[model samples]
Target chain A: MSELHLEISKVGIDFPTPKGPFCALQDVNLKISKGEFVSLIGHSGCGKSTVLNIVAGLYQATTGGVMLNGREVNEPGPERAVVFQNHSLLPWLTAYQNIELGVKRVFRGKKTKAEMREWIEHNLELVHMTHAMHKRPDEISGGMKQRVGIARALAMEPEILLMDEPFGALDALTRAHLQDSLMEIQTALGNTVIMITHDVDEAVLLSDRIVMMTNGPSATVGEILDVKLARPRNRLELADDPEYNGYRTAVLRFLYEKQKKVEPIAPKRAEKAAEKDSSKQVA
Target chain B: MSESTTVIPTVSSAKAASKFPTALVSKISPAKLRDIVLGTCLPILGLVFFLLFWHVGAQHIKTSLGTFPGPKEVVTQWNNLVAEQKDEYAREAAFYERQEKRNAEALKEDPNAEIKVREYNGRPTFFNKIQTSLFTVLSGFILATVIAIPMGIVIGLSQSLYRAFNPVIQIFKPVSPLAWLPLITLVVSSVYVSEDPMFSKSFIISMLTVTLCSMWPTMINTAVGVAGVSKDLINVSRVLRLDWLTHVRKIVIPSSIPMMFTGLRLSLGIAWMVLIAAEMLAQNPGLGKFVWDEFQNGSSDSLGRICVAVLTIGVIGFGLDRTLLAIQGYVNWDKSAVVR
Candidate 1:
């Protein structure tokens, strides 16, 4: 019971591409305790987003699936909400309405009209987006839209929150502000979060532990570094702290130099010849 | 850049004043004004110039049949025709009333009999032609929508079904409504055969033509729309683990709505235009028929009457297209300039 809220046991993803069945993820195993913020950091196409997508059930793993709270994860449900890289808020909806949509879908029968409005507004305010709640995704800045997306997902009150580079589209300053907001929100809600990003700095700032992934077409967890920085960490203050640099340096070394230890292979050609084995998870 | 350099802090422009217009014209740029004025200007000018040319050309007309009516003469003829129609109705009413009285007198012995006149009347009046055309256009548009949307969804969902249907669609899409009209007319007439041959069969031809011609755009566009729904959006639906109905209602339709509306609008315009052309070919009892009948008359007034019919078709077609476009705008969620 005390082990982890989320568990991935030897998960692999091999998908058929035009070239062949290419391997995206390779023999990756990880665990997240309840309320832990875990970030996957790696170079582009290292399958960090693919891992997050698998957790989100946007895709499935070839060898393994995720288990949440000791139950095997099969399908996507509202209990697991996603924040996409592009902040895929339904552009047609206002911020309040977007959050309301998630709320209404998740909490269908119990809440009264006033209660629903209060819930939506409360989440919007949590993301510091109460004032811009009426704005559509296009009318507001990219950062604001992502805040709305975060609010919308959290408002669903999912058991696990999966974010796939939710702030990649925003400018640096805005990204920093959101990072703080996200950390505060995570601390308050105690959500079991698995966020994927290429930004090593973002990962170091936000995650309780950072999982650095190897370069793909066959990728795996190369290293896991604990972020031993103190709580309620301020971005600029943490940047100046020497401990943050130590963790960042470890991640950088693993990403740039230590990646050479993993062997790379052509994954597609193998999958095609073995297509008769229908159980192969072409995720 | 050089001319506008001095105007930085001023409320008014400090440019060479002659290059710009007075206060009123300068308020909105000439380019913007041109856009507004151009919308109405060319059509009005064309009408005026056409009338002038016709009026001059009318003088040279020495036809074997009779003198052709000028635009002014046509306006006078139209007024006289209105008067003649009123008189005709009055006479016809009086004639009907007398006939009714005679029938009533004769019906002293036969009260169960149907009302019968000496001649067949109620052939479509001029206004009735336009009304029937409008009715047929709208009804056919609705029918096309009913068949196309679901079919499009099916095709969009299945690769094999899409492949199977592709050849059928391709073959039918380019075939003109005129080609379909006779096939439609003959089939309806034979299959819908009745004791009295009461069905016009023209109605069937017009409706079928509308369906055939309009179906392609709606089918193709709706399939494309459904296919183009974002993968990320679908993932949200999946993670929410939505039911099939919920996926369609919450995600699929909303995402595909803009494209669906585009399909509907395109098909409607196509149906409206095609119905008229189809009617003309099939000799259907519609505005197209009215024009054909007018053209067949060997009189100088025929072309002028044809001109009126042509004008009405254009106006009605424009009105329908605008109405559909308005609906498209209303239904579309991504109303901003950008889709993504």
Candidate 2:
């Protein structure tokens, strides 16, 4: 096996709100090896996406840092391509043109025009978006638009692919279809990936390891569950498989049982008040 | 899943089909008569009603200049103006012929004779005034667009530049063309010194005044548009590590196009409006000068002629706006955007 490809060590991010500084993520650490698929899953507003953005270098961490291939990540570059949740494809450009934009930037003068055309076409075909290549983003369906977004990310041939809820906006069936295609592509390319998703099944089926986060104001990693599921896992076959269900259950337990609280800070305050009374009686 | 995905491509194909002009309704379709009536008949009816109102209102009004000229009087003056234009053109042709004949005779008598073919000094007709107005306004508009677009891009790219420029832009934006005319006229005449100038001082004054008043909209709109480019697109550019020039050309300009065109359309409208006022106040040779000249003459026919000039200005302004609207449709990426 190859050595570690990405290391995010003790990253904490803070945003200034009108009230004061708001902590989005805190004390987060994770290491992803080459060709590894890691999913960061948590409830909404748990800073899972924030962690992904930090790794992608879209957001700067207030404390700690991210090291990609032994280099400190400070800014975004072509080596790390991101598939945004909204499918951020330019509305003015066609799918082919959008893909070409990244390809031209990454591989300018390195490949012949014919080779570049094949590269773009191959990527489109990878996501099965060849038929809608000529249509602009507005003219395509939400699902097709997302496929083009994925195709664009793949076309860049990044060392590590970062996706922030790539299929979060699509309908269930479309999302499932995209997930299957993603699994196939991941198997074929063996690219390192760090995806942020909330779906337990999606995390289990697509990831080698799932990194769960506790609920935020200051969210941190709660647990890391390793999925030992076999490669080429089928969505239908995994429905009844006990091993697959076991991984899903373990994640659900960590999220719902161990980390469950109605209010993030109120319970802690109540416990502090009880401790104060006990201390007064002892004195 | 296949069935659902197949369903979406049909929608795109249908949209593409509907995008054609002929797809409004086929020749074989049953609603052709309705389309024609709605398109042409209603507009004609509105014009007829307007003419009726003008004719009826003219009878009741009594101004010191004279009774207000109605549609009939205005049309008669318009016909007279057309005849005058034709007569002026005939005189110009005769002037050229006489010059040519004199030049030939001089050359025949003395092979190296210093003979010149000078332009005819004749009174400009109504049509000539229209031409002058169009030429001046378009020159000013093109000048404004050239300066405003690049300036706008620069200011939009940097927050500090925008902040530095914002106060100056806000101050100058509201200054009227009328107020600027006197200063422009003095500066133009004093600075534009030449024995044989390509353009007259008055023309320069009017053009500069129009440029000053009209440039603000385009500049402001461009700045706003460039600054308002989607954050997602900005992120994409950052991730791609595109150079500054490439980022602007590929992302900023294309995304800001719709807003930029809106500004251009507004600036053109202001330029046309400002040119007329600049011409009227500065007494440059345009439709504005014709109107002012007619007012000074104060003859019975003067009112009618002034009416004709007013109507011509309105029509030309409409035509210029329509031309820009058509251009906006052509240049804009979003074809479905309603430019009108």
Candidate 3:
């Protein structure tokens, strides 16, 4: 791998609660290379979003920090554009205007007005949202809005794209469509991306490396699986490919068996269940 | 011949039956008919019923002036006021014409005489009072909007500021224009001394009273709206690294617009109401003064004229609210979302 593009070192965060500080993440570490696509996969409430937020510079890690190209990441900047799960496009602005907003901010003095317009149009075209660029977020479909959100982040020409479940809110068909488009865009731009997802197939399909996380109160990196898939991967062909299935099975085992999630039970219920199991064993 | 007659009757009856149902159904669907009835017809019917009740009830309530003026009497008085306004306009025109003639003659004689123009000193008509009330209320409302919106935004952004100013706002919000009127009058009379005053003392007093009372709703609502901006949007701003001014202009203002407008609408309504009350209490030149003068006059026409003023006030208030609502609808970008 080339020089590390982004490094998250021993990151830990404790959120203040009524019962004192609750540790959400501990000793979380990852090093992502330039143009590498990294996926953080975990069960619900495994602090996947927390890690993403810390990297995005939205939440500061109490013990350690994130570094981008040798610079310590403290506050959010346009260079680390985030594609939020909810799309987060200002409802008042049209899709084109939403992209224009970030484009203008990042390239205010660097790019001329005509150049900026072309760049925004280009980003919208990348997401296949050229037709509905004039429409507001409320007027567009959920998937289309997500496309606009991606376009907005891409318009900034950021070094890293932080997406927190970019296609999580979309329907299955739409999700597949978006995933295809995302892979195409990532291949073209070669932008380093860190995506947090719950879908096992999504992680396996898009990620260069899948970083599975353990469950929290102190969620940390459990294992890292590097997929040596060829360029321009096809979902249909991959279904029958043994290598793809092998990778998919590996991730499934890691999620289901290695870190099998136990349903949270009340202390009294757990004690009763323990007693029942012990009594069964004696019988 | 009997078979032909019977067939003709049956065919004609069938034709009539088909025509009646189709014509009614084509003209209005059940949903549309319901909307029309509920939206337009019902309101008009309610108004007509109210008018009838008022007209009948007014007859039994005899006052010193005579039987309390009914709808007919109010209409008559309204026409009388309109005629009086027309007469006043004619008198003003004559005054200006006479002055022009005098100036022309003097200039012709002296060849270098300066034309002296004077304002017409005629008594203001009912229409003039209405104009004065509108002008004063708008001035006060506009001033309140300018001060409150920015102040509200600032207070909303800072927790300390909001906490510090909330008490002051709460205390002042519930204050009556009547209570503020005397203090405003005293302050204006003492402090606003000038040889050539731009605005009348009464106008300033009434305006100040309106401003004091009407500004609270806009301020509080703007604060609430600004504070209530979605957390996700704020994060978007942060990620963009937007400067403070840009953050406010792009995210805060746009998101809080609906609430700010809500505040503005409330403030405008309060301003209008406060202006009238202040005008009545301070004897300022407005519709409120017109109503008060009619009440004091206690002539046979007095009660009827007062009724006319009451109806005019209600109509004007309704018109102002509708105007604000229209503006809100135009500016609000979320077309799918219901405004009202």
Candidate 4:
């Protein structure tokens, strides 16, 4: 394997609730190498976003911590750029200006005025959003706005990109288009990325490794699958490939047959129901 | 023979239509015509009907001075006020010219003569009173905005500060301008003593009263606006690790602008209303005072002039609100969003 770039060790977080402390995650551990694309996939409420948030330094883990390039991650920084679900583009700023904001923040004393402008234009070109560069977020379509969001995160030249369901709000076609763009960009840049997603196909299509999480009330990594697909993958050709189908079935079996989703009944009610079943068996 | 005659008439009609630009007529669909009638024509018609009602109603109600002034009499009074303002300007110009001539003559006669140029102490015309009221109201509004917006931002950003200040804001919000006028008057009279006072006591009193009564809406609305910034944007700020001032400037101010403008418009409306009331009660030299003085004059023309002032006040208030609305629309980035 390559050099260890990021590490999540003994991570757990307990949120204070009216019912006392509720553990959302516990003993979650993962090690990622440089230039690796990792996807965290699980059922809803599985604390997949929680793990990404912890890595992004937006949330502090109660037990352990996240390390980036051998430094403890405590607070958010421009080096760890996040592409949020809703695009999170400032409505008041144009697409180009939104990218400019992060670029200016990251490249302020390092890049000259013309260099920054060229860099901003290049990132927009990378996402194929140079045409709508001057349009505000409200004026653009949802998919276009998400493209700008990606461009903004890319323009920062971050060490690691964090995406929390970046395409969840988009239509299926738009999602596919964005996924293709993301793959192209990732291949070209070789940037480290950690994305949270619910779509199994999306996880398999993009990730170097998929980290499947268990259902929460203390959710942790259930399994990790390494995809050894060749680079420069074509989704159409891979659809008919036997190896691709094998990997897809493996993930499906793990999600449905092995770690099946259960209805979250209250603890006391579950206990009482279990007692009734055992008593009936005794009778 | 009948078909040939009908074709000839149609050709002539077509020629006529081509000469007159028939595209405009063709463009007005039934819906477009209805919009024109409802949007433009109906408002004009309503105003005409209102004038007619007032003209008829004025003759039947006899007031203490005389019959209430009708539209015709109000128009005459408006013209008279304009002429009076012109005369006042001419007098002011003549006063300055005479002072210059006298000073030059004295300097020529005694090479070191001390000459004094006196200010024109003429009675303020109707237009002058309008200017005074505008100036006072604007000054009060600006003063309030400068103090309220920053304070509101701070209070909104902090939970404990909001808790501490909320009761005080609520208590003072509803206090009337009239209630504050006497206290403001007394305070200005005592605290503002000087050898040559920069502002009149009545002006200060009216302005302070306007400020006190009008500032609450802006402060409260701004606080609400600042507190209600969307969580997604806040997360973006956190992820960016924006500094405190940068966060406030980039995220807080832009998102809260629409609500802040709403507060500003409301405050301005209240400020205008409070200034007039304060001016009237305090006998300050403004349109309010003019109306009060005309009522006390008990002359036949006085009622008509008072009617003119009333109309002018309503028009000015409407104009001020429209101006603020235009400004709000300009500053707001979401052009598709209707500001009102």
Better of 1 and 2 by DockQ: 1
Clashing pairs in 1: A21-A268, A76-B239, A77-B239
Q: Judging by TM-score, tell me the better candidate of 1 and 4.
A: 4
**lDDT tens string, model 3, A1-283?**
5878999999998765444566778999999999999999998777898899888888778899899999999888989999999999999999999999899899999999999999999999999999999999889899999999999999999999999999999999999999999999999999999999999999999999999999776889999999988979999989999999999999999889988888675532433343334323221
For model 2 the TM-score comes to 0.88
- Would candidate 4 be rated incorrect, acceptable, medium or high by CAPRI criteria? acceptable
lDDT agreement of model 2 with the native = 0.88
Considering the two chains of model 2, state its CAPRI-style docking category.
acceptable
Tens digit per residue, CA lDDT, model 1, A1-283: 1457899989998776555667778899998888888999887667787788678766668888899889887667777899988888777778998788778878788898899999999999999998998988889989998999898899999999999898888899999899989989988888888898888899999998999888776789988998989888888887778899999888888877877445334443344333323222321
| Per-prediction fnat | 0.65, 0.78, 0.89, 0.78
Candidate 1 DockQ category? Answer: medium
lDDT of 2 by residue, A141-253 (tens): 99999999999999999999999999999999999999999999999999899999989999999999999999876889999999999999999999999999999999999
DockQ, 0 to 1 scale, candidate 2: 0.36
Per-residue CA lDDT of model 2 for B125-232, tens digit only, reads 888899999999999999999999989988988878999999999999999888898898888889999999999888888999989999988998899999888777
Alpha-carbon shift of residue B330 in model 2 (angstroms): 1.0
Scored against the native two-chain complex, candidate 3 gets a DockQ of 0.46
Please list the residue runs of candidate 4 whose C-alpha ends up more than 4 Å from where it truly belongs after superposition: A19-21, A259-283, B1-20, B94-116
lDDT (Cα, 0-100) at B248 in candidate 2? 90
Error of 3 at B79 (Å): 1.2
The backbone clash count of each candidate, in order, is 3, 0, 0, 0
Q: How many backbone clashes does candidate 1 have?
A: 3
Measured over the true interface residues after superposition, the C-alpha RMSD of each candidate is 2.4, 9.6, 9.6, 9.3
